[model samples]
Target: MRRAAPLALLAALGAAPLAAQDSAPCGGDFGTFLQGVEAEAVASGIDPATASAFVAGLGPDPEVIAADRRQGVFQLDFLTFSRRLISQDRIDRGRAMADRHATTFDRIEAEYGVPRGVLLAFWAFETDYGAVQGDFGTLDALATLAHDCRRPELFRPQLVAAAELFAMGEIDHATTGAWAGEIGQVQMLPADILENGRDGDGDGRIDLKGSAPDALMSGGAMLQALGWRADEPWLVEVTVPDGLDWASTGLNHPRPVANWAAAGVAARDGALPGGGPGTGLEARLLLPQGRNGPAFLAYPNFDVYFEWNQSFVYVTTAAYFATRLMGAPIYLAGDPDPGLSGEQMIALQEKLVARGHDVGGVDGILGERTREAVQVEQQRLGLPADAWPTPALLGAL
Candidate 1:
């Protein structure tokens, strides 16, 4: 299940009309919010001149809020999401990038243990290989999100980090980024950039926006922090035999390759997905669509994908597409059981939340949390623990 946290953060700031209404500090004025932020910045040891100059006249971005409410990616199924994001054109562009930056990629891979194909796939997904990174200023976007009532708690730290970067003269005040304050083609937040950003181009500075090498290298550093294993495959498509313990599926339950092999698990194709099979790798089964869809066993490095994005579809597709870029065949199979309609999913979420299972949200999106909740519900009802939501569940509820 993909967590839409980053997207959830920045979905609402846009070039919307600035509000005409004005109010006192801490009431409702955007100016007041900016002033408060500046005061806080000065107290935090940021240069008073920089703080005052930075927040002056920053307006409330109403359009960003509008965009936030209209997010439909979370509502999309894996098949639809994959089809929309992992297009042939994107693959082609990725391949071209890989070829063009072969030297840089080879060097980064040799140094960081991250493959070129993986970086290319992520680059293609993040900003279409540096083609369309958003135009929102980082400070403005973070500030706007921090002030928004929906998720102020989440964006507040990011806003502070952006300010710090500005204060240090690391990120220019005019630096543009995605709505969520993600800078460069990789769409990383200010903190992540400050912490993991690298001088990939070796030009004495880190410029992720202009330097693909920097983004890719910095991204590899971030993955290393998340426990990505160079020796292990992130995930591998696999087949699960009938009569298996359905509850054992998902990322939380990993087992040795021998354990899964003993239980009749095997690769979808003839060979191990990435590395050789004799490596004694451990894996957790990931049935994105319950027991009736494309299943894979996630390895250690798989955790790094979640670090990149909470969305299973987005992360998995990036990993999956990376393999495709390296000449591996795509998963051409269909789900044995389809996903639920939006209304059905919404109903299911409401029922699960009412029961205190923590489905995460009642927003109709079936993610890992919701699926796990469904599994618990199924177990309680003495049904199969495939972790799928169905019409049968609705009636049971």
Candidate 2:
């Protein structure tokens, strides 16, 4: 899921105006919200005890909302984020954890057909391998988000699912430990916990808090359900030939490897991996830092990484971390330009919009659509079509 924006954090804290009210009308009291929620739970067939226990102390939590807002600023750059999250210390810790819980990870990989490294990588990323599950009350966070107006439509159902968890005795109101009501070491949402979590430890309880086996196994199970191919790579860094037609490479428009080779696109070492000719997998050419930076051929499984975290940088970092875990070399190329500011990006978007070009939503985030729009404008202006955002581009705009 995308990290909660600043506005989302404010709304979750009940600092923003209610969606139902136009001009800061009287807000719904906690008592009133709980009463309505209790009624809904009972009508939804939940027992009274479960409903009361779940809703008794639920309210807006300022600290959690603050944390959510702060998360947006924590990882400003991909390299910094990767260095912190996938540090040598982290890798050593993960390897030790994997060794200690070899039986659990082995069984999980065998059953789910997910690589142990990938599962371990996710475990390390989600909660620092259980070393730092958030200390805030999970119920409070869920209740705050559910009662808040900005994304009540998205979080209210999660609130309902949390109540169901309580009703089923899967978890009590006291044991949950996620930022947004996600439970367990893997930080799984309530619905995912209900659907995919497993008792790998076989202790007659699905304990995610204290059981490494359960958490790792549950994570592998979720990935399996998402169609993780056991032997296929998620993505690979490749060399794109000069003068290659980037428009031909899109997510929906796939061509065979042979066809791509015919078009002068070849693997970096002049040898394609053993996926056979014309595997029919669609791919896209990704130039994260324009024409001078390292390139990648992303496949469908790359999209699956986005399901975990929507940010392109997040997915790319995960893929890179996976490569590191597999003993692959780090990316040797540097980003062409990393100093672009949010204001400059916004200015560029405004200029594009003024020119009657759609750059998608102008949130100052340079996504693929924004990059493509910038490239089109650059081509129209007789500039280089590298699709990179720079201060010079902003000046031209």
Question: Clashes per prediction?
Answer: 10, 0
Question: 81, model 1: CA deviation in Å?
Answer: 1.0
Worst 10 residues of 2 by lDDT: 16-25
Candidate 1 lDDT score relative to the true structure: 0.72
Residue pairs clashing, model 1: 2-310, 2-311, 2-312, 3-310, 3-311, 11-68, 12-64, 12-65, 13-64, 14-64
Query: Per-residue CA lDDT of candidate 1, range 303-351, in tens?
Result: 7887777765667777787777877677755555756887788888888
Misplaced by over 4 Å in model 1 are 1-29, 270-280
> Which residue pairs in candidate 2 have backbone atoms (N, alpha carbon, C) closer than 3 angstroms, thus clashing?
none
